[model samples]
Target: MDEQTITGSTASEIAASVRALHERGALRTGDALPPVRELAAQLGVNRNTAVAAYRLLAQAGVVTARGRAGTVVAGVTAVAQEGYAPDSVLRDIGTGNPDPRRIPDLSGALATAVGRPVLYGEPVIDPALEERALAWVSADLPGRPVRITVTNGAVDAVERLLAQALLRDDAVALEDPCFLASIHTVRLGGYRAVPVPVDAEGMTVDGLRAALESGVRAVICTPRAQNPTGATLSPARAAALRAVLAEHPYVLVIEDDHFSMLSQRPYETLIGPEHRRYALVRSVSKSLGPDMCLAVAATDPETADRLAMRLSPGTTWVSHILQRLVLAQLTDEAVLAEVAAAGRHYAERNAAFAARLTERGLPTQARDGLNLWVRLPVEAKVVADRLMRRGWLARTGDEFVLGERLSPSHHLRLTVHDLEDDDAARLIDDLVDAAR
Candidate 1:
């Protein structure tokens, strides 16, 4: 048997050498590298240097470390489906984006951020933004000594939070019909995703218990306006989940409240007071706009420290200008009114579309969020194809499923909030015809 050797004096050099091997096709997926001590001896470096190199590789998604089995090249991560076709003339209702017209205008807010020139070594999070975010997130959080951090977006926050607490191959509990970005993040990080089936009232208690028993290190949940499914955690459901999580108080629990200000339902949390590791992430993407690219993460002090290590000075801090822009808009009375109206707009539009589908005997319900999760009698892919033929693009539920292969799904997630009444009716009629 031939042995694979990576040579470098330092951690960065060794990581770069291994990366080169991967890029050159010398190291394929699942191919194990030399043991840490052996690699250190072979490279003439200390053991800690080799370990640091491996850790850097794991964080970069280039390789994964399995406790006893050793580190190996990580698998290719799947990218989330976003945006639309440039050449297609179809009406794109598959894009999970908030209505642009409803997004608060930022021109005035940008002007207010020009008073001071922020330089290096300054605070990572904007002072005003941090104070406002602390108050907003603390109101719903149950724990004490709540610490707040800001990241570029909800996806960035979740990625960093998971990276700080978990190693590659560690099991993470996720909602079955998960968010696409979440699916991509977990897979790309070389982590195992344990599916916790989600129902109309949020994550099933039995599924959660099963996941906990399987020794999952972390659980990622969306408490309200769950993507694709549009399900909010009912009070009873939240309590049941909290009870189950109480048994495993140390498991890292992350709540992504992406629809924070835009959701019609009250915020329900899964973290209990005694739980040790937890983070609640709220982003302004839906309410303010995705382009703003900012989210506030309220977490336990220890978890905050771990996350801060990665977000230190020059590397990955969220821009102060963007943070200030968000704060300026958040404090404005007129902007608050617009955001409230936008929330109502999404709920009303989704509800109206669901009602239209129900009237046509399709029996669809848009519980919350910007999209409607419609069940079709046929497979979602087949229905999606038919809809495409009729000049419409809809996203199939299979795209959101996690695991080896996609399970049979007869659902289509359609973003119809921006559609006009006449257009929506036409799409509904077309959908009915296509499904039949």
Candidate 2:
């Protein structure tokens, strides 16, 4: 269809019209969409609205933006995901996972969780879990009243939060070196991702400000132990971000504290006392076990209600059995101590590895979380090839970068905290040699 045939006054309507035309064969693959200004003029709408509409189409994978080449019709391509490659024989150090030996044994907690058979129409969150979780989340948040909601994990909580607050194509502020799951979720949901650069101190203020100015409706932040980089938000940085967000009070802020109890750093939140729309989600996956598959979310009453509607009976409730098990372990002093020690163990292991790299002339520092973000002398891809040849698999930093920000990244994110001393030393030698 030509520009004249493209009709609609609103962003959603315009996107729908374009989709209809494409489905009817009036528009084919590789067809160039009219420029934003031209389409806005034709449709009698604002230029920004047309841009938003185009952005929505792009995020949905219906159209691809080729920079100077302009936007063209293209289908969505498959996205890369995180996890182990079951058949790979190389020593895989790229898998960002908690040390399995440290994950608390759930056998004792499981006995307590299995006693009650939950039926439909019953409460989704276990009362014990709810009480404990509320206290856990509220301790770091503002003193204002907060509501709790249970979800499968941090990713699920984030998905629900964004789904409830934002429409398709709406811009969302995400960290530049963002979590893989966050990147995947936003793209699949058809939401525009505005990258906010992460420095040694979490999300940068200027990057966040630029995103907010671009009319982003949501912001997903990691308060501590951010993935890929392992950068935790410093106290001053948190205050700065909160101030920036204060000016844009209506923007929905979602804080994913995925490395909660296992974090060596303190949690510095972004939610202001008076902010209306926000959520703080802490998952038991990292500290307890990934198999637990449960997270506790604390949010404003209205947001919680909206989330509840989406998680209503018979639809998508987190298992109460899982919730109870988590609560039991959280309350058990011995388990809590063990979890505390595990956190220390991770920190020590990563620090030890970093020291080895530094001593070998490749300066590196262990921040937080289960991995080490190391900068190489040359491109990470080159180093990764060398490592693979040496029988080790590693992830390049470019994998976590958004857009062309870190093209040909000179960094590698290695998960060596779980490795034995000898293996760690061997990998270190290989890594240093690979960089050379």
Candidate 3:
């Protein structure tokens, strides 16, 4: 072979070719590639050469290795390349998602949001949405000063807040067994996550006091309807938490009120008036629809402006259309009524299942959320396996753990909705047997 042909045979050459394809939009992330053996044979190259190229690409974060599923491209905007393909066979039990049947339609409201698209560098946020959101926040936190800015979602809000307030390696207090996204967001953003213990009352005041003592700059909490465990912060617990936080006014508090519209529980914000700095991220995903991808970030004006600076012509802005649509849904009396009804329905159904477990001597506790946290007599992992064998899927407690090496409480986080009597009876029977 000549010099040009010899170069093509090198692994770096293959990698460079792949990189060029990606740059030209031919090789995109999330796209599946042929198996190494097959690809090598197709390219008339040695198997080792192809393996080395794939390895190099993976090291560069250009591709991902899906065990038993083969290699796939890993880059930005790879809708065509990766994931449990739009039509994959695996049953997804790991995704902690809501039932779409519950999310109300907003076709009519969306029609109002789509006006003439603004020109380049034009403000992406809707003025009408800002006005309505201001009114909404005023109702929630009367007499307390605040500012509102719309974001793509709760994750976006958290990311922006951390970006503005923290530098790499900064410590932030997060609930132990925290929402996976919250933990991941902090860790990925180069901030350290300090575990704050959680109990039935929600995050313990002791935990907050300790985290502050350790010099955490920020704290992220789910004031009500905590994820995974789904526990609401009791008013007494909130007061205690505020008492501890008041001592450290400089530590920014971020309360994610994710279940506001979907929970029948009373509203009690933990950020006391005296605690000068904090932000509240409220999203409609759980209450409305996941596709909405909209959240309202209410914070002090300085923090608001920092967030706005990130949103201004210098950075990406949330869609005015989505904001307007959310505003329309919020202002509509009928939609509000429907959402309230959905909230009650979720609560009632979930509570009913918990009651059934309680009646069976399992003694499940009733909390305010779309899911229930049930404590089994044995280890949760074993119980989850048994449930899976019986054609039911449930989340184990160990998955939500943080820094501390505490034994799991034999607890199962269950989502109860649209239950069939036979399946429900079978699951309860299996759980009873599993517990024994």
The model with the greatest TM-score is: 2
lDDT of 1 by residue, 45-161 (tens): 999999989988987889988779999999976565755645778888888889999998888898987668777788888888889999898878744679999999999999999
Write candidate 2's Cα lDDT for 119-184 as tens digits: 889988888888888889777985767999999998999999999999987989999888999999
In candidate 1, which residue pairs get closer than 3 Å at backbone N, Cα or C atoms, i.e. clash? none
Instruction: Rank the candidate models, highest TM-score first.
Output: 2, 1, 3
Q: In candidate 3, where is summed lDDT lowest over 10 consecutive residues?
A: 76-85
Prediction-by-prediction clash tally: 0, 0, 3
Cα error of candidate 3 at position 96, Å: 3.3
The TM-score that candidate 1 achieves is 0.84
Model 3 misplacement above 4 A: 1-95
State the weakest 10-residue window (summed lDDT) of model 1. Answer: 77-86
Model 1 residue 276 CA deviation (Å) reads 1.0
User: Would you list the clashing residue pairs of candidate 3?
Assistant: 30-81, 30-82, 31-81
Query: Which 10 consecutive positions of candidate 2 have the poorest summed lDDT?
Result: 76-85
lDDT of 3: 0.78
Tens-digit lDDT track for model 3 on 1-436?
Answer: 3322212466788877777777777766787877888878767899999888877776566888887899888855322111122543433233455667777788879888888877668766677887877776777666667888888899899999989999866899999868878877886676779999888878988888899999999999997788767778888998888889888887889989888888777666678877777898889988778778999888988888888888875258887777778888988888888888888887887788888998998999768776678888899988877767766666777767777556765887776655666766767788898888
